[model samples]
Target: MTRRLLLSHLSLMLLVLLVLEVPFGVFYARSELSRFTHTAQQGALTLAEVCEEKMEHGLSTDLPGLARAYGRRTGSRVSVVGTNGVVLADSAAQAQALVGRNVSAEPDIATALRDHPVAGTRSDASVGGDVLFVTVPGGSDDTVPCVVRTVYALGPLKAKVHATWIALAALGLGVLAAGALIGFALARSFTRPVRALERATAQLAEGRLTDPPTTDHGPPELRRLAASFTKTASRLQHLLQAQQAFASEVSHQLKTPLTALRLRLENFEPHLAPCAQDSLDQALGEVERLGRMVQGLLALARLENSAIRPESVDLGAVVADRAAIWAAFADEQRVGIVVADAATDVRVRAVPGALEQIIDNLLSNALRAAPPGTAITLATATAPGEGGRTPAMAELHVIDQGPGMSEAERHKAFDRFWRAPDTDHDGTGLGLPMVRQLARAADGEVTLEAAPGGGLDAVVRLQRADARTHRQRPGGSADADCAGNARPHGVMAARGHP
Candidate 1:
C-alpha cells in the first residue's frame, strides 16, 4: 500500500511538470531563434546602406575588403553581387574562389537584385547545413543596383536553443526529485498511521483489547478513527465479559437443582416397577446429557474468551494414554480401541489440556458411532508442512469403522448445534465446534475425512515441538517406548466431551 501511494504521487508530479514545461520549452526555443534572426537581418541592412554609399562615391573597388572586414568582425559570410547576375566580391577567403561567378540565382540575392529586401532562414545544401540569409539592394537611387547578402550559420543558434532546453530539463529534473522526496515523506506519514491501525485491529480480533492505539498520532481523521476503534474494542470487551459471566452464573445456579433431581430419581428407582424404572433411567440419562451440554457450553465460552499459552507435549504419549482410558468404555459397547504402539512419544506445542480435550471428544464421538465388533484406531505420526519439509507437524488420527458422513454433512458438522440428519446416538451437537475451537486456541487444526475402510477419520494437527528438548529412551526409539508408567491419568473426565 505504501509503494502504491508513492508511485501515484510521483506519477502525478511528473505529469504536472510535463504539462507546464513542454510548451514553455518550445516557446522559449522559438523566441531565441526569432531574436537571433532579427538581429542578423538588421546588421545586414546596415551593411547594405554603407555599401550603397561607398559605391556612389566610386569606392566599389574597396567593396571586397570592406565586406571581408565586416565578415571577420561578425563571423558571417558576406558577398557583393552585380545586378547582371555575377559575383562582384566575396568576404570569405575560401569563397573568393567563386568571385566573378554568376550567383544571382540565389533566392535572397535574386530578391535583393529586384530592389526588394529579403530576410529568412533555409537549409542550404551547398553549405551542407541550414543558414540564416538576409539580403538588401545596394547602390544609390538611379544607378544599377547590386546585392549585399549576409549569411549566418544556423548551427550556433540551434546550439544555444538546445543548451537552454538542457538547462530547463535539468531544472525540471531537480523539481521532480524534490517533489518525489516530499511526496514520499507525506505518503509515509499517511500510511504509518494506517499500518498501526491495521495491527491494532488484528490484535483486537485475536481477543487482545488491552493495548488500543494511542489515538494521538497521525492526521486528525485517523486520530478520530483510532479513538473510535478504542471505544468499539472497549464495548466489545465489556459485552463478551458480560456474556461469560451470565453463562457462568446460569450454569452454576442450575447445577444444584439438577443434582437434587438426580438424587431424587435415584431414591425412587428401587421402589418402582421394571417399566417405571426403565422410564426413570431414561429420564436420568436425559438429565445427565443436559448436564453435559451445559458444561460443554461453559467450556466453549471460556475457550472463546481466554487466550491459550502453548507448551511442548508428547503427542504419542497423550494419544496412548487417552486410548487406554477409553478402552473400558469401548469394551462395554463391544467396540475395540487400539493405540498404535509405534506412536509412543512424539511431541508438539499446544495449550495444556488442549490435546486431552480434543482426544476425549474425538474418541467419544467415534465410540458412539462405531458398531459392535468394529475397531477404533488412535495413531500419531508426522505430516509435511506446506512446503513438505521437516520439522513437520505432529498429527493425531482417530479412525473408526462407523457410518461416515457425506461431504456436505462433514462441512456443516463443525457448526454449533448441528447434527446429522439420521443418527442413532444422542449428542449435544457442540462436540465438533468445541473441538475446533480448542484446536485453534492451541494453534492447531482438526479436520474430518472419510476413512479408507468406510468410517470417519478425525485428524488433529499441531505444531511440532522443538526436537532439541526430546531425550531418546535407552535401548528404544523415543516414539516406540510405551511403558505403562508413561500413561497420563484422570483422562475419562477431560472437558469438551459430548
Candidate 2:
C-alpha cells in the first residue's frame, strides 16, 4: 500500500512536469535560436555599413582587419563581398587564399547582392558542423555596394539547450523523490492507526480487550472513529461479561434442584405400587431430560460467549481414537463400527478439542439412527483444492447405514435442536449448531449429505494444517501425541458425552 501511494504521487508529479515543463523547454530552445539568428543578421548588416564607409574613403585595405575584429567580438566568421560578389575581405585564418574566391555563385551572396537579407542554418564543411548564416546588403551610393555574411557555429547553442533539458530532468526527478517521501509519510500516518484498530478488533473477537485503539493519532476522521470504537467496545465488553455471568448463574441455580428432584423421585420407587412406580419413572425421566436441556442451553451460551482460537491437530489420529472409543457402544447395539482412512498422517486445523467432539456428536447421532444389522463408519480424507489456488481441506466423515434426511431436512439439520420427524431420542437440539460453531471457529464448516448407500453422511470440513505447523510449534509432534485432546467448543449435550 505504501508503495502504491508513493507511485501515485510520483505519477502525478511526472505528469504535471511533462505538461508544463516540456512545452516551456521547447519554446525556450526555439526562442533562443531565433534571438541568436536575429543578432547575427543585425551584426552582419552593421559590418556591411562599416565596410561601405571604409571602401568609399579608399581604405578597403583595412577591411580584412575589420572583419577579423568583428568575428572575434561575436564568435563568428565574417566575409565582406563587393557588388559583383567578389570576396574582398575574409575573417578566416586562410584569408589570403580566399581574397579572390566567391566571385558570386553562393546563394546567400547572390541573394544579398540583390539587396535582400538571407538568414538560415545549414551544415558547413569548413566549420565541421552546422552553422547559422546571415547575409544582409548594406552598401549605397555614398560608398560601394557590398554584402556582409556572418557564419556562427551552432555547437554552443545546442550544448546550452541540452544542458537546460538535463537540468529540467534533474528537477523533475527531485520533485518525484520529494513526493515519494511525503506520500510514504502520509501512508504510514493512515495505516498505523488502521493496523492498531485491526489488532483491537481481533482481540475483541477473542473476548479479550487487552489493547484498545488509541484515539490520539492519524487523521481527524480516524480519531473520531477510534473514540467511537472505544465507547462501543466498552459497551460490548460489559454486555459479554453480563451474559457470561447470567449463564453461570443459571447453571448454578438450576443444576442443584434438578439433581435433588430426580433423587427424591427415585427414592419413591420402592415405596409405591408397580403401576405408580411406572408413572414415577416417567417423571424422573422427564427431569433427566430437563437437566440435559439445561446443560445444552449452558453449552450454547458458553460457545456463544467464549474465546475461540483453532489449533493444529492430527486429523487421522483423532478419527482413529474416536472410532475406537465408540466401538464398544456400537457393539452393545449389535451394530458394527467401521473405521476407514484413519491411519494417514493427516494434519488439520481445529479447536483443541473440537475434532473429538465433532466426531463424538456425529457418531452419537449415527449410532442412534443405525439398526442392529447396520454399521457406522468413521473416515478421514483430503478434499482436493481448487487447482493450486487453494489449500486442500481435511474432511472427517461419519457415515451410518440408516434412513437419510432429504435435501430440505439436511439444510435445516444445522439449526438448534433440529431432529428428523421420525427420530425418537431425547435430544436438546443444540448438538449440530455447536458442531457448526466449532467448525467455523476452526475456519471450516459442517455439512450433511445423502450417503451413497442411503444413509446420512455427516461431514466436518476443516482446513489442512499449515505446512509449517511442526516448525512453528514448540513440540513438533504435539498434534500426534495429543490426538484425543481436540477441543470443539460447547457441542456436548448431557447425554452424548461420556
Candidate 3:
C-alpha cells in the first residue's frame, strides 16, 4: 500500500515538473538567443560611432589598428568597408593584403554601404559553424563612405543555453527524489492504522478478541474510524464470550441426562416382552439419534467458538492420507476409495484440520448412501478465472456414485440441520455448514453439484496458496510438494447428510 501511494505521488510530481519546466526551459533558450543577438547589434553600432569619429579626425591611417584592437577584446571579426565596395581595413591576419580589395558584393558589407543596418545569422566556413553578424553604416562624411561590420561565433552562447537546460533537468530530478521520500513517509503514516485494523479483523473472525489500533496518529478521519472500530470489536467480543459460555453450559447440563435416558431405556430391553421389543428398539434408536444430534450441535458450537487461522495445506497429500484411512472401512462394505492421479501437486489455503474434517464428513456421507461395489473418487483441478478479474482457485471434489440431490436440496443443504425430505439415513446436517465456514475462513468457498455420472459432488473451492495470503505455522514444512512433507493430522467427529 505504501509503495502504491508513493508511486502515485511521484507520478503527479513528475507531470507537474514537465508541464512547468519544459516551457520555461524552451522560453529561456529562445530568450537567451534573442538577448545575445541584441547585445551584438548594440556593440556593432557603438564601434561604428567610434570609427566615424576616427575618420572625421583624420585618424584613418590607424583604422586597421583600431579594428584589430576591438576584435581582440570582443572575440569578433571587425572590418571597415568603403561605400564604393572596397575594403578599407580588416581585423583578420590577411588585412594588409586585402586593404584595397573590392568586396562590394558581400551581402552584409553591401547592405551597410547603402546606409541600412544588417543583423542576422549565417553559416561561416572560417569559424566551422554558424555566426551572428551585425553591420552598421559609419563615417558617411569621410573621403570614402565607410561601414563597420562585426561577426561573433554563436558556440559559447549555445553552450550556455544547453548548460541552463541541464541544470533545470537536474533540479527537477532532485525535487522528484525529495517528493518520493516525503510521499513514502506520509503513506506509511496513513497505512499503519490500516494494517493494524486488518490484523485485528482477522483475529476477530477467528474467534479471538483484539484491541483496536492505539497508534493511529494519522489523519483525523482515520483516528475517528479506529476509535469506532475498537468500540464495536469490544462489544462483539463480549457477545461472543457470552454465547460460547451458554453453549458450554448447555452441553454440560444435558450430557448426563441424555446418557442416563439412553441407559434407562436399554435397561428395560431384557425385561420387556418380545411383542413390545420392536417398540423398545425404536425408542432406543430415537434416543441414540437425539444424542448424536446434540453432539453434532456441540461440535458446530465449538467450531464457531474457537479462534483458529488458516494456513497452506497440500490438497493432494491430505486426500491420499484420508482416502487410505477410509479405504479399509470402505472395503469391508464392498466400496472403494479412489484418489485420482490429477489430484496430486495441489496446494491450497484452508483451516488447519478443516480439510480432513470436510473430507471425512463427505466420505462418511457418501459411504452411507453408496451401493456395494461402487467407488468414491477424490479429484482436484484448478478453476480458471473470468477474464483475469477473479483469481484462480484450487478445487477438491469428493465425488460419490450415490443418489444425488436436486438443485433445491443442494441449495438447502448448507443450512444448519437441514436435510432433504426423502433422506432416510441419520444425519443432523451440520457438516455442510461447518465445511462452508472452514472454506470461508481461508477466503474460499464450497458448493454441491450433481456429478455427471448421476451422483453427488461435494466441491470445496479453496484459495490457491499462492493466490491468497498465507503463513506457515512455526516448524511447519517449507514446501508442500516434497515427498516427505509432514503436517498435523486429525479426524474431527462430525457426520454429514446421507
Candidate 4:
C-alpha cells in the first residue's frame, strides 16, 4: 500500500513537471535563438553604415583590411560583395581568392542586392561550419550598390541554448525529488493511524477488551472512527457478558426443578398402570433430554465467554486414551474402536479440557452413527508448518465408518440445534457447534470430510506445542503421559439428545 501511494504521487508529479517544463524549454530555446539572431542583424546593419561612408568614393582599396579588422573585433566573418555578384573583399578568407568571387547565389546576399536586408542560417564551406548570416545594402548609389554581410557561428548560440535546457532539467529533477519526499511523509502520516486501528481491531477480534486505542492522534476522520470503535467494542463486550451470565443462571435454575420432577416421576411410576408407567418413563426421558440440553447451553455459554489459557497436550496419547475409554461402548454396539500407533509424539497447544471435550463430542457422534461390525479409527499426525516459520501442527483425525453427510449437509453440521434429516440417533445439535467453538477458542479448527469407502472423517488441527514446553513436562510413561492424563471432569457426562 505504501509503495502504491508513493508511485501514484511520483507519477502525478512527473506529469505536472512534463506539462510545465517541456513547453517552457521550447520557448526558452526559441527566445535565445531570436535574441542572438537579432543581435547579429543589428551588428551587420551598423557595419554596413560604416562601410557606406568609406565606399562613397567607390569600392575602397583598403576595404579588405577594414573588413578584416571589423571581423576580428566582433568575432564574426565580414565580406563585401558588388551588385554584379563579385566578391569585393573578404575578412576570414584571402582577398586574392575572393576579390571577384560572385556571392550572389547566396540567399542573404541576393536579397541585400535587391535593396532588402536579410538574415538567415545555413551551412557555409568558407566558414567551415553552419553560420547565421545578415546581409544589408551598403553603397550610396543604388546602381553601384554593394552588400555588407556578417556571418556568426551557430555552434556557440546552440551551446548557450543547450546549457539553459540542462539547467532547467536539473531544476525540474530537484522539484520532483522534493515533491516525492513531501508526498512520502504525508502518506506515512495518513497510514500510521490506519496501522494503529488495524492492531486495535485484531486485539478486539481476539477477545481482548482492555486497552482500547486513544483517538488523540491522526486525521480527524480517523480519530472519530477510533473513538466510535472504542465505544462499540465496550458495548459489545458488556452485551456478551450479560448474555452469558443470563444463560448460565437460567440453565442452573432449570436443573433443580428438572431433577425434582424426575424423582417425582420415578416414585409415582410404581403406583400406576403399565401403560401409565410407560408414559411416566417417556416423560422422565424427555425431562432428562431437557436437562442435557440445559447443561449443553451452560457449557456453550461458558466456552464462549471464558478465555482459556493454552497448554501443551500430547495428541497421540490423548487419542489412545479416548479410544480405550470408548472401546467397551463400541463393542456393546457391535463396532470396534482402533487407535493408531504414532511414529513420533505429536503435541499441540490447547486449553485444558478443550481437547478432551472435542474428542468426546466427536466420539459420541461417531459411536451413535457407526454401523454394526464397522470400526472407528482415532489417529494423530503432524502437519507441516505453514511457510516453515510457524511450528508444525498436530492433527487429530477421528474416522467413523458411518453414514457420512453430503457436501451441503456438512456445511451446516456445525450450526447449533442442526441435525441430519432421517437419522435414527438422538442429538441436541450442539455437539458439533461446541466442538468447533472449543477448537477455535484454542486457536485451532475442526473440519468434516467424507472418508474413503464411505464414512465421515473429523479432523482437528491445532498449533504444535513448542519443544521447550514439551521438555518441561514429565515424559516416558505411556499411561500417565500427556495423552493418557485423567479426563476433564464432566467432559462427556451429559450426552447430547435432540
Summed backbone clashes in each candidate are 0, 9, 0, 3
Candidate 1 global lDDT: 0.75
Q: Write one digit per residue (lDDT tens) for candidate 1, span 397-438.
A: 889898888888888888877777775445778778876776
The alpha-carbon RMSD values of the candidates against the true structure, listed in the order shown, are: 8.0, 5.1, 5.5, 7.2
Number of the predicted model whose lDDT against the real structure is largest: 2
Candidate 2: regions farther than 4 A off: 1-14, 54-61, 81-89, 94-114, 123-129, 139-145, 170-192, 383-391, 467-498
Top-TM-score candidate index: 2
For model 4 the local lDDT of residue 148 reads: 91
Candidate 4 structure quality by residue, lDDT tens digits, 411-448: 88887887778655445677778777767766678998
Q: How many clashes does the backbone of model 1 have?
A: 0
**lDDT computed for candidate 4:** 0.75
lDDT of 2 by residue, 192-291 (tens): 8888888888778777679999999999999999889888999999998999899889988999999899999988888999879779977987897788
Q: Candidate 4: where are CA atoms >4 Å away?
A: 1-14, 84-88, 93-131, 135-145, 166-196, 213-223, 244-291, 306-332, 337-360, 377-399, 405-412, 421-426, 438-498
TM-score, structure 3 vs. true: 0.81
Candidate 2 worst ten-residue window by lDDT: 470-479
Candidate-wise lDDT, in order: 0.75, 0.78, 0.77, 0.75
TM-score of each: 0.70, 0.84, 0.81, 0.69
